[model samples]
Target chain A: MSAELKKALYNISALADLGQAITSESVFHEKIQSVFYVITGTFLANRGAILSYDKSADRLITVTQKGFPPADLDRVDPEKLMSLGKNEPFLIGDSPVLAIAGVKILAPLWVRDEFIGVLLLSGKLTGSPYTQEDLELLNVIAHQIAIALNNHSLFMDLSDKLEENRRLYEEMRHIYHGTLQAFAAAIDAKDAYTQNHSYRVAKYSTAIARELGWNEHDIEGMYVAGYLHDVGKLAISNDLLNKVTPFTPEERAEIRKHSTTSHNITSKIKFPWQNVQDMVWHHHERLDGCGYPEALAQESLSDGVRILSLADSFDAMTSQRPYRKKMDVQTAITELKKCLESQFDNKIMLVFCKVLEKEIKGELPEPDILPYLDRDSDLSVISSMLEAIIQELSAP
Target chain B: MKTVQFSVTSRLVGDAAVIYPKGYLNNLSGESLVKECGIYIGKGITKIVVNFSETDLINSIGISLLLQIIEDLKNIKGTICCTNMSKFLQDTFEMLGLIQYMVVFPVESDALQYLKVGKV
Candidate 1:
């Protein structure tokens, strides 16, 4: 009803506008621009600037400004402003450090003990002196703006830390994969015939696990399990591992101890993915209770172990071994199909067949298994064989 | 209360520009009104008539935008005529002593007639 009441209501509405601008989902620059508009509009100041204190730079950088000489705003010392009271408006007298041409008021923005920024406003356009109420209103607006700026600063700090952490994690992961490759190479180096054997198994297991709808984390675990499954072979004597003759039961028993040794080696290290140890340990186990060491039967073995088991055997069959010549792609598929249900899970076999078929048909962008296979082999014959196997395995 | 988004439209009438501001005129969107006036001022038009018939509500932000237009016209030694103002708008301008900065009219035609006669 009265002019004072109307002006007060307008100030309250301006505060509401400030609140809306700060909380809006707009990006940082837009939100700061909106807030600048609210402040200038509320005070009817013809010239104004919102400056945020960059503590690192120890300078007052204008967030948004208008009608002021840009050079004058740039020269403002944040340290001098910090010496002023927090969130309190100080009339800009002809002080040496703050003697800007047209600025009539400065509110040093602070949250707690931290100096956040400053708000500058020229004389009102109406050519009237700012009342005590106007000063109080500016102080309130300054407080809100300080909080907003401080929140932005905090958010930026958190974002920077998160980005740094993400970069560090990526670096560590690169190094981690490198270390695993070196370990696999070391295991493969024990015997010339099994060169890159661990690498192929890792790829095959990863492809099968992916096709089986395992998440990326689990697929990574499967890959690691495949790579490290023969880590115990590092402990086995080189003569026993590369022996050209068929092993006696005594030597066969000695060779089987590598899986248990592999489990012992991996179990000491904590892996991000669950059951990596179990997957490496039980990779030699069979569903028909005929497997070595633990002899884990059906349901005792996890799908991860099943995948590693199948991948290991497939790579071993396709690769040249000292005891026997390598099987062709078709022969390997037949061997795998024949051994299914006895040693491997039907679901894992089906997924393996489907993935291999996809790789053979040139459907997968990066064929994990096909690259390591004998490239000179007839892919058409292998594709036909895989298609038949997929059909057979997919049948009820 | 539901707010209609603010918008500005303008047309050239003789030597003067007529700006129609619609909706609440209560936020940064109201800047378009100032921008519309600036366009005419840039073209060397000395007179602006803002018809506020559709703008039934305005806040301090709106007043600040009005002040910016008034200041712009003042700097150019030009005239700003506000017409078709609601009662609230008139009272607000009068209370803030802003009525003296510009002429007011009850209708758009009256402001156009005044500007036309003044052009003579």
Candidate 2:
């Protein structure tokens, strides 16, 4: 092969290597600085700088530089530079895109036939006009530089879009959280006696989870499960919910459907944690396959489900109800242990016992005086009154 | 203790409906609030001044419902202003970006002035 052909092959190989490294470099300043060194060294030039075109803004931005005056860099116009012939370097005296000193060669860079930037190289170290072969090598190098700049631009744009998406996701999450809190409050308002039941359940569930060494997300999932656990009861009658007497067989059947009902209501809301739905649905289920709705056994249950069950029971025992006396801390603790391995998960019960061990031993705060309704006299009378009111509202 | 029931009373003044809500504004109250606003919406009296002078103890549920009311009013190119908000409610509204889209007044007179002018 001819000497010219061999030199050109080596130059192309060197340019190919530079192309690979520049595409992967993350920081723009470092990337352009490295490419500027390569350009200056390849042409044996004294000074150089890259002027990258911002096509959208119709402006030029400084990519990198070596020995160029700041004023000259500011004065450079990328549009005018891009209009130059791809191969030809303009002499300082003859060039139209000048007022800068020491910059003797200007070459426009392109990739896939699209102009991307300009390489401004100063007078040669030997102080002579660049040879035809020097320009040839520079042309190949310029193409590689263009490819790198294009890749960098695309990478920057993608990063900006990703940041924008993250912000939007956070905004939507805030909205959903506020909405869910309102709905949870609505569930608590199902009856005057059950007020704040969801909030208390959520707190107790997370406390047990913390005692059991569950991760933050699992603990939070338990809280969400507790908050949304009783939403299904919305479809049941307020009279039934607030009735002080033990429900009859038919009434018990109506109440049993609430677990599944809650699951259905919360499923539409789409909680961040999927397992929360299972926890809500299976909270009433027992260990020996006697639980309602799903009748899920020990093996079918997640640890979170057990934690929720424990929290639900703990709050129910402590809460003041007009008909049934509230259980003391000692009685409640003993009751949980007595039914362990049958009605509740033993391990989760242990965790709850340990976490509340301090609070149980301390002063017992008086429970609130909840609005009381009896099924025998008050509820039936209230039911009729409520029915009358409903009829009145519905009437034209 | 059980929460008190929520109630809203509305009166017409010029072209606006001035609403006064009583009791704690939680989940139960939030529902009544929407229905109260709905009555005005139905009547085509879109200019509204919701006064909180008689109420306090609003929760997240109440705030969510209030956001809905504001959005409904905006859809009709109508203006709604809130009056007599405590410092806490004002801070909550500003933090949630609610103030960006609506004006909050320190008194009923200020709200009425804004509603009369229909812009802030």
Identify the candidate with maximal DockQ. 1
Q: How many backbone clashes does candidate 1 have?
A: 0
The parts of candidate 1 lying over 4 Å away from their true place are: none
Alpha carbon lDDT of residue B23, candidate 2?
A: 77
| lDDT tens digits by residue: candidate 1, A71-130 | 888899887888899999999877764868889998999999999999999998788888
Indicate the TM-score of model 1. 0.96
Our model 2 lands, by Cα RMSD against the true structure, at: 28.8
Best by lDDT: 1
Model 2, A94: alpha-carbon shift in Å?
A: 1.0
Residue range A304-352, candidate 2, lDDT tens digits: 8888888788778866764588775445555776778888876676556
Candidate 2 — which residues are off by over 4 angstroms?
Answer: A1-28, A85-93, A112-115, A207-220, A269-272, A328-330, A353-396, B1-120
RMSD of each: 1.8, 28.8
TM-score of each: 0.96, 0.62
DockQ, candidate 2, comes to 0.00
